[model samples]
Target: MRDLKPWLALIFKRPGRLVMGGALIMATLLSGIGLLAVSGWFITETALVGMLLAAGVAATINLYVPGGAIRFFAVSRTVFRYLERVYNHDTVLRLLTDIRVALFQSLASASRRHRRQLTGAEWLSRLTSDVDALDTLYLRLIAPTALAALVTALVVALTAALFDIKTATLVGLVLLVAFLIATIGTYLRTRHLAARQSDCQESLRTAVIEYIEGFAELTAAGRTGKHAAWLMRQAHQVTSEQAQADTLAGWHLAGSHLLINLSAVLTLWAGFALFRAGVVSGPVLVLLPIALLGLAEIYAMLPDAFGKLGATAASASRLNRDCQAEEPARDTGAQGLPANAALFATNLAVKHPGHAPLFTHFELEVNAGERVGILGYSGSGKSTLADVFSGLLPAAHGNLATRDLVYLTQKTVLFEDTLRANLLLGAPNASETELWRILEVVELADRFAPEPDQLDTWLGSSGSRLSGGEARRVALARVLLNPAPVVILDEPFTGLDAGTRARIAKRMDLLLEGKTVISLAHGPDALPGTDRVIHLPG
Candidate 1:
């Protein structure tokens, strides 16, 4: 139980507005219930008037007034019903969005570390299904349930005042018992159902994402049957969970009907005896149980009453659990880039759960304006070293420092935007003079190739629309635009031909002047001017 106090506390932060909205909804529900009670009054009053001769026309006029009251209630309900839908839906979606944003922020720290442990399905569950399920909280559970119970209680009070005020008072006591039995019983029983439903959604998401992402590979390797069998298993598990929840819910539903039936019967027995005693008229007797019938219908929908509490609990649990990985920082919350930097790392080490140490007491230093080459066989800790140096790695034990560093991995990254957008990402407000100056250094001197506004041309997937060497150089150009004090490159020669490679090597010296540079190289022979070269033992 992580605790849901903070999340529930959000409900009261907008107290005046929430209460006002709730009050309006309550007013609407009461109007509808009042129409029911007033119609019952109309029936009873008309019946009683029929037995008297001289009272006929005057009684007809009296009945018509309550009918007019009933009509007014109907018109008001219809008017508010339209407004309620718009406002309620907006409130539900806003709540859902808030839940989603909170979950994202909570998971932000842990997600980067346990990427594999947090599956697509679990994410989808929280983002889509779990949060969506919370709509039941405000819509079905809180507003409608609160309104129904309150109005029904009022009707019960009205019934009691009818046939001897004392008898009506007893019915009020019975209404209390009826409400307690229905509301509390359903709450204690079905509250856990939301959390269980959230879990079910998570499981379904995982199975479905796994089934979809592996579809092509499974088809290629002819393993469709195996995947299908796994999906079937998950489906069965989901069904089993559903059946269990429904079984519990079935008990509550049965208990609700039983309580309502008992309340109605009790009201009848109590009210009927008074009718025969001349203590109450036939009209009062007939309407006493009808008012209880009106309340009985409302109490039967108790599941809708307490549903939001369960949803809030479920969402709060999901968010708190996901955010457990977020570590409170002891260091000041600043990641400033060092200028004119000399990189230093001494006794650096990092180990993973199932793997041996990537670096055990490793050490390296790069002097300003010096180019260092890192050559190693695959799996010899090349990219891992770059990650550690660039503040992206969590160290087991190590010291790593640089004032400012521009690091690029072997895998080229492109955004879905224009060429200028990707380049300006590092320094958003760079001038045209600064942009053109760096572009010429990378030997991409042309202002435009196919478009009049070359820099402004719409690029796809981190400039995948550019050729391989062009994309590499363009990515490099973006790094240049930042003008960081340190530049680190991992396998930048990949996907380039010999001419392109030579051109990049030529461009690197011109573009990376006065920067502390490190390159994880494929071959030492390719980068001749690299001042310090360290080769991993082959």
Candidate 2:
């Protein structure tokens, strides 16, 4: 409900668009009646030459009037769609921003121990998908739907006036009945749609993000076949569900058209019979069918829109559910840490799924000048611990807190961006010396890749073209350049050769000597043997 307010405000803010849209609908309805009126005259008027000619002229005008009315309606819809985009986008973006912020805090709030229950995809999902899920409401449910309903009602009323009061009333009654039925049917299925759509979308998002993020791991770690196969399976599942949703929506729309068509036919037949019986006039008879218009079809459409909205609502509800899965950890990590230190995490415990505990009651304290190595057996929870201490995982049970922590993962996540642009994330206004200094840390100072024109070299996604060791060093360089108090590494030297690792290690030790460090060990020889080895009690 709280999230609904901003989207509602979006509909209200563009008064000009709303008015234009309303007028278009009103005019189109008027045009529908004019068409029936003129067509009826053409049908009924006989060989009174003057009456016939007048009728012909009126017919021509009415034919053109409907087109003009449609043009206005189309133009109005276009303008409305534009405003809808702005307002809807803004509202959803705002919600997403707020959600991400909350999740960020939640990540901090959950003690460091909670980090094991999360994946890169899960975190990214919270940041991107959950917010995106709410967008379904804006795009599918709100604007077009409201406009469709308002216009349909207005057109029905105007058509009633053009025909006899009785005929008008009948037409309205028929449209109302059809719409009510359609809406009811749609309403019945809406909950199903919501649940299905939310699940499918979440799965799709999780699969895609995980595939992208773990592609390298899957390749280097030999999980590619398994991972790719799993992705195919997930994709198929999402597609199947989406196809079902679309099929249902399409059927609903078609049924609506049938209902609308039926009402139009009934109104025309009844009206014409009355006119022949000398109970009504030509204009009324013609206008009755014409008035049973494009708008009337909206009665049928309302259900589908509502159904779609229900789906979006389902998605939003699920996302919110994810948010409230465990209430926001009320503890703020910002309390006792001095801002000047490189990084800090206190009493951080990380746990994993299908486990009693990753590390029971973990405690980590890194001060101004120290390098701490986090050690654990294979699956013993080194990376999980690293993630916890760095504020990536929020649910770890024990007093989790960090100050100025920067995480350098084994896989260097570089966009298809330039050398300078990538570095800009750390320090946007870095000078030449700064860049050179950063390059020095990674031992890439004098060696330049000539493939890219200059500092604006576009290293492809995940720094693919570069060797794994080079990419790892590049990420390390980025961390070195950032003026942060703490540097956290999760097997940052994974793919590096022994010499390269040793060289980079020496430079890092000197540069990070005064800063707190937490590096997760991969092999027994991983890292330069830090000040402390955190053990995982199996």
Candidate 3:
């Protein structure tokens, strides 16, 4: 329950939608029960009238009222059912959108170290399956449980009015037991199994992905057959556990139904006594029993939903752990940047948590509109420093200040989207002409211009449609598109040939004329044209 608090808060954000959807569901359930109870009463009334007419005794019955009510409930059940499906499904989709947006925002704010600890497969499960579980939280678990209790109370109260307090109390007690069997009993019987099954499915997904990714290596080592067999066994175990949960849910469902039917039988038996004593009429006697039977429809949904409750909780726990929000500890000693400086750092210590400090008492200042380069070897913490300056990472101890900036990381990242869309991420309001100009500056305009879609050409996943050099240039082009006063580039010219690097570097000066550029690279050759350069010791 604690694990579900955050997600439940998100789900309840749309209170109006949830309330309306619940109303529709309630209406549908009531109409179905009303239809059944009224039909039974009408039939019993008609039978009594026919016998009275056959015995030559006058009898008056309002056929029109009962017939009209039956028609009304029948039509209402169908209409409400359709509306509930449409409205609730739409609400679920909107909630899904809200949840995904919130999840992504939390992930974006999380530290790089935390994110780095997660595998791609683990992230996928959190985003897809875990988020998917929360989307149905309102519709599946909350609404049904609440409405079932409310509807049952209403029905019990109706029984008291139609029959008597003693009989209603008896019927209510039976229903209470049936509700417990369907809900808590199912949950207790299958909670561990369901939670374990959810985890097993995730593990299997990760295993299969790893298996396919390492298939060639496994074959080379002659272990492919063994690994494949292990995956098969895991998959089979997941299926078996799912079967066990379903079996338990089925038994609980059967028990609940049996108890519900018994309640109906009890009502009918009790009603006869009341009917004989003139405490209840024949039509009223039939109505209570039929309405008791109508409760089967509501109880039918409880067992299946409660059985999966454990899995939903597990999913929420995982999401909360993975994407939990954290506020960085602010340093009171930190100072603001000087008016002329684009970036300033003083008494800075740079390192990851629980590790040796990379740099202590580091001091640096770059004036606005200065193109400064930092040169170091591959393992010299050049990228880490770049991260600190760009604020992607925090300094372990120090005062650090920077103007608004855009950073191009050491790794080239491009989405599976159009070429134009990828570039627009840097500057959303950039015109097509500006996009083509940036592409030209990066020496990619000619490469894409020959294609039919040109700017609209699809860049496959991670820009797989382009060569390594081409992808690197596309990333560089995106950074260059930003209008930030400060620009941080780490290994900006990676994957490009020397001549191409020189060409892009030459054109970069005019493009970034007014900006403060801090470019980190492995060697002097890798550094672009700079006003001054700093070299870090090994």
Best prediction by TM-score: 3
C-alpha root-mean-square deviation, each candidate: 6.0, 7.7, 3.6
Off by over 4 Å in 3: 53-65, 329-339, 346-362, 394-399, 419-421, 428-458, 464-474, 481-483, 494-514, 523-529
Cα lDDT of model 3 by residue, 1-538, tens digit? 6898888999999999999999999999999999999999999999999999999999999999999999999999999999999999999999999999999888888777777778898888888888888999899988999899999999899989888899999999999999999999999988889899999999998888888888899999999999999999999999999999999999999999999999999999999998899999999999988988888989999999999999998998888888876666433222588888988888999998788999999999899999899998778899999877876677888888888899999999999999999999899999999999999899998899999999999999999999998999999999999988899999999998899999999999989998999999988888788999999988
Question: Which sequence of candidate numbers ranks them by lDDT, best first?
Answer: 3, 1, 2
- Candidate 2: which pairs clash? 110-394, 111-396, 113-349, 113-350, 113-396, 114-395, 114-396, 342-485, 342-486, 343-486
Per lDDT, the best of the predicted structures is 3
Error of 1 at 353 (Å): 2.7
Question: Per-residue lDDT for 209 in model 3?
Answer: 80
lDDT of each: 0.68, 0.62, 0.91
lDDT of 3 at 471: 92
Q: State which candidate, 1 or 3, has the greater TM-score.
A: 3
- In model 1, pairs of residues that clash are 121-205, 137-308, 141-304, 160-168, 337-403, 338-403, 338-404, 414-462, 415-462
TM-score of candidate 3 against the unseen true structure: 0.86
User: How many residue pairs clash in each candidate at the backbone level?
Assistant: 9, 10, 0
